[model samples]
Target: MNKITKALGLSLLLSSAVSVYAQQPPKHTYKPDGYSIVTIETPEDVRFHATGLDSTSTGEVYVATRFGDVWKLAGDKWSKFAEGLHEPTGLLVDDDGSIVVAQKPEFTRLRDTDNDGQADEYSMLAGDWDFHDNYHEFTFGPVKDKAGNYYGTLNLSHGDPDAFSLGAMGSSGGYRGFAFKVNKDGEFSPYAWGLRSPAGLGSSPEGELFYTDNQGDWVPTSTFHLLQEGKFYGHPVSLAQRPGYSKESITNTAVEVFDKIREKPVALIPHLEVANSPGNPAWDTTKGQFGPFAGQIFIGDQTQSNIFRVLLDKVNGVYQGAVINFMNGFQSGNIRNEFDIKGQLWVGQTARGWGAAGGKPFGLQKVVWDGTTPFELHNIKLTKTGFTLTFTDKVDVNSVSLDSFSAQQWNYHYSGNYGSPKMNLEAVKPSKVSLSADKLTVTIDMPLTADKLVQIDFPGLKDINGRNVGVEKVYYTLNQLRK
Candidate 1:
């Protein structure tokens, strides 16, 4: 009687457990159409707060962590490659198989001299700029151009009394708040000045260098800039670090003078709405492997914990374009993105000092295209009179009307303030709206204006398959109009 009663009780308990498990919701219910996120597991004891990511031609993925360790991922295995770095924020795998990293104090090259699986050789490639031991002085690149020159961006100091302070940031050491270049011969030079917290850097498919700066004092908002030589990028406090300018001189110059000479960013990533602390811009050169948005830029935000797509266009010989929401729901703050040869995007995340939207402190994840194209905005081109909106799929013309679209325009005032509020915000109604015959393009005619951020929303638009557009709003930086 005892054996039969015990067996019957165990069977009922196991059955109840299975029933409850089946009733629970699945882990990833918010699956985005055409893209899926795959989390790569890290050791529980390791911080794994990834700041930079890259891959080798042989398919090994390397990650540099903010805790000063580099890890290599081969298949399902993880191994430490290097250590003892001072918060490396960016990593690159060179053509000759050397690994380069931008640590807070120097640009280092890590190599395996004995053909071991770990990096044994740590060489200082460049450390010309002065470091004042401030926690906010982060270095952020090693993107090599076709000419073999490596580039990087340096962040300004945060709490140094002697540093020239303006709005929210300060610069005291040499070349702080500047973009620098190191030649193949190991020579270093400051390329561009006036950056506040340039967190990430990358090279476009055509070899143009670009960077993402966080919004702070002197910087009205987060920005994406085409890093050109000798250009000032709106942060006046950094001008004190320039060769001829002193702290007194920069203080004496009016804000208007700096504003007049500073080169505008390619795109102003809207503060809070889009990105609070934007990271690197990784261009989609994966052809069709990563889906339809080839040649566009994909960037991640630390505070937003999301990935946003940038559709860039050359208008009147200058780069200005739109920023559209792409994907969110990551595990931590996404700070770096690297596309592998198989066309998957690897995101490195961290939430150290200021924290991030994703509840975790650090993680690593990859985004893969499911081969199904999402019905969304493919690109936004500025026209002579208005804008031409192109979609990834055919639109349902019956679902669109004049009431489906609304727009507003505003400009940010250039000041020494923490961050400028939207100045002179005004509603911009489209004078004419026309859907193309093929149903993949929409043309909106409006009174075009320069130096304004124009946001257009088409909330209820649907594709031919009756699926709602994945992203309904786009923010376009109208710096120039197409002739």
Candidate 2:
């Protein structure tokens, strides 16, 4: 028989061979000092779960919750700004101050028709999902790349019930996940295929998309797969051997599929015990050529309750491989796991499901780098900030603390306060500004001062260990308003 025929004939055999090898738990070294954790207030003090968070250029915070709700963090108070979502996972704001949410199986554009704070109607931007069965568990992303196109992922929660009795292993036919894109007019189309549970989705500085998947609980190892356009990262039949299948038979079939996906992934994190702490995945884009992380990918491991950094070494235009490790830990032993955002090498995490301080189960943390012979920061942008500041890469937020800018002048620096910056810019109106876990933006208000010079500093930004947080600065000359 031909290659395809031969592979199919012994597909069951290869599956069994892969099963004999037990998956070992991946090691994650602790870096408690890499991050500066800051807790933002939650809407419901009694009970709340933060699903999605993003900042605007003006510094307003938008946080999505489980109860079909979106909360805004302004100053110290939380307010219900948007509602009627069925498990919001990803949040993004457009240049027009419009908000978009990926509410599993649906990508929704929430608009406030009357200029009211709350969204009046939920406009279906573009989503083609079978929401009835995979309603809440599936993860759909509405992330807009620098090019303005929207991308999202679909996740399969559980396998089919009949497949279990039929000697089938892993997800079989019930729910197959894929990635898709939406046009400007809200048309949904398939982008890529072959994903088990792609939960977290984000793009790197190089315009590559990365996603996290939850393999079947029965499998020995879970997987974190990366994608380009239409590549399969091995799932369902590839990760685990079928229950009654022959090892040699399935192994051959899997090799062919593995080859296709193996090259696409920047790294393969072996998932042992609880999906290997898989959560949101992002890329660090905060370097102007001086440092170790000119092009690195960052992700969060929920199971270990830590954030991970995957450094990529590309040789001759091809990605040779990557080095993975724990970037930082949160709240002593608390699970500061999942919902990750990145600035450059600096990573921000949202605290969830743990008895820790800082916004308990809902707040933001900043990871920064210290400038020395080895580290540097450049290509920074205020980007979209309001309630949060979304960077092209991860940044040290603690060092960039806000103390309300004074008209006279001030001196501020980073003392491990997330290696932010020295200058602080305060809004003319406290209510005009908002904050979130990672983004900051300006809304409605005109620019401040003819020559508004805002400076931010970071004194204690560190690496994985407790070192100095690096310094990276961006300047925006604010022009006075025209009367």
Candidate 3:
């Protein structure tokens, strides 16, 4: 067997352990063709810099750098638009073309000011005034809602002073938690609290907000927390706090907070040993319900360097949810790990290597949900039958079916007939997706057959809403099916 076939066999064996729900696996009939990886040039002196990317109504894309500067990518040309700011962590473009940026303790606003596409007026919306400690516990950039309100998390640490320290600061409190909002009128209101390091924000189809929190020592031992608005989320207490606060109880301090809120997040995971640092959460509104997430939320994990898509069910108006680790460890750096975009998740790697190491040059990365692409193959033997396709996307011990390819141009086919004749590309699950909220890789065994070629549809897979997935071509070869 060739190396690709061998790798495919092993990959299928590992995919079986993936978490399965009532939904069927997304089918793939073919892969993309004429596809190639294109690497862009990093701006000179761009080392040690993080990125914040946001696109405008036009095709213009704006990127914020870690070194306190803003750059614009107009087509293939990169231009430095703004300079001399603090460590700009996040960036967002508002409805009226205004820009919102997160620069540590302050959330700043920028406007074109002169009818130009570039921002000319820069103003600080909130800050402690002290240059050294105007900490709002804020890091990630603000996300604007259809109602014109801005929302995001503001995490503050509070464990061991040494572990919680950051950016030249001496001993500091661990990131407490956050769920804050800025209204259309610019009025800022603090909502949910008790998050450690929530690096990402996402809104469901129902307009209810959701966030991903990182768990550490003295906190959630193994899982990641899903932030719900107007809820206090027993931060120091780590979910399971229904039994009257003991150790790690932030509920006791509720009276001290102005809002006096008290609601816990939807506990997403348990002891999986998957460093639970869940980051940016984006909802897919196209397939499910209309406005809210329809119970879907996507998050990024820094420690494991991965991403996830969680479904939040709103039965009878009560929101409940579960997380499916979608993407696994990226071959990018560590540190500032993130994935926040409308279509495919865009990962930002700043650490080093594809594993759990740190201190590497930072760069922006993307994971394209190419429905046409075939997942890694699994379990193969060199015997006759031209190589039996033993594995299947599922293991129901049922019959197999042969269907047409999703990519009409490629003419792909699968030997397995157990599932439906029409393969749903949207339902295609990653073989070795993430287990934790972060980027740890867990191999999942997805069964298949030697004679079957999965059909993957492109149009069926849409964005957060029901938008169509666009690609140039579909590529698949029979050679890829054997081990």
Candidate 4:
């Protein structure tokens, strides 16, 4: 087809999609109680399809949008701080009040030198990697470590094109699916590879780096993986940057070799059940100021238009954990989130390139807990028998029984498919139930299964006061059975 014909065809298809999308109800319709979602109004001039969010010590909020602009929200007033940036996916407010952002081509730091409320000094802290001009070549990052180094992830180009609109088999990009770290002196280097569409990057409270990668051809499932150097995270295309690495080394290698070498996700989220495109993770370190689940990670989904909570546990020096659906019915696709000093969550949302379930195109909302502690299992600790669950309140053993619990074990296939279906499903029967004297812990008599996911549903588990569990389901990744 000719150029004009192709353009017309694409335009028509997009318009038809918009017309169809307008007629359907939002994907997220269920509204949970006790928590309120307050929409914070952004500026009227631009479409505030915010993708990055951070806040300063003085309570000023900063946001980076897909339109290449960064703004600060202070006491209901929006002020433009920076402009004419690329598609920025992440934002961080440094300790000195400077704005650090991760744009498509590089990571940058913007500073308002004159206190004029606008950034006059723009510094490109990291660059010179590769850009293929492909539509899917998006970058996400600039999250800092305790040592002041900046980190980001480069996404693999998905289309069949070259860097300059020319046709090619692949873009010949460098470090496309790799994660990099920029030192304090602006030294940029690739740190980890095998990442495809890694949308969010953050540090755990324990000071370990982690990122969220989406499900695709090489990715078996949406996962949350701890960032370890030299780790090939299942996607082989990124191994090109490794020293002496080859395509044959990856493609022809056995699954056992890859499994033994590459790292695993701390928590594997089921497709479309909890998250479709999980975004950034923000931990609630408020020590009960936020809620009962302190030091837990709360993540948002762009397509799912919801939020979920993750609890991590280390077994044999490796991280594995549980993921639970926390809250839903957000105003848009949640891409970036920040927890303020007051313990309220600031969610920046967008539906620009992807459709969201909240029925809106763009919005900024504040998620606040209504001060009511929800009865929930906080974490699962490994034990010799099986595992022990710690809850927010004392468990009433009278309300917990075999009838209230049902569990099974399942594993995923390591392959090149779009995703992995649950394989080797096994029913797990609880041989006994042991409650702690304090009522906060419950030990089950089920035997521990190594390297398997235990799918537990506690529909009848209740707190000491007979309050039903707020989160009924939890998928625990039990990697190792301890003695």
**Which candidate should be chosen as best, given lDDT against the real structure?**
1
Question: Per lDDT, what order, best first?
Answer: 1, 4, 2, 3
Error of 1 at 409 (Å): 0.6
Instruction: Write the number of the candidate with greater lDDT, choosing between 1 and 3.
Output: 1
Give candidate 4's error at residue 418 in angstroms. 1.1
Is candidate 2 or 3 superior in lDDT? 2
Give the number of colliding residue pairs in candidate 2: 98
Q: Is candidate 3 or candidate 4 better by lDDT?
A: 4
Candidate 2 structure quality by residue, lDDT tens digits, 358-398: 22344444445444333323222222221122223333344
Better of 1 and 4 by lDDT: 1
- The C-alpha stretches of model 1 lying farther than 4 A from their native spots are 1-32
All candidates' lDDT scores?
0.84, 0.45, 0.42, 0.77
- Whose TM-score is greatest here? 1
Candidate 1 structure quality by residue, lDDT tens digits, 254-361:
989998999888898877677777899998878999999898899998766788988888998889988988888888889999999889999999977756678799
lDDT of 3: 0.42
Which regions of candidate 3 deviate over 4 angstroms? Answer: 1-40, 114-118, 128-138, 157-176, 221-229, 236-264, 270-275, 285-296, 314-317, 333-342, 352-360, 373-396, 399-483
Worst 10-residue stretch by lDDT in candidate 2?
Answer: 5-14
What is the lDDT for 169 in model 2?
34
Candidate 4, residue 202: Cα displacement in angstroms equals: 0.4
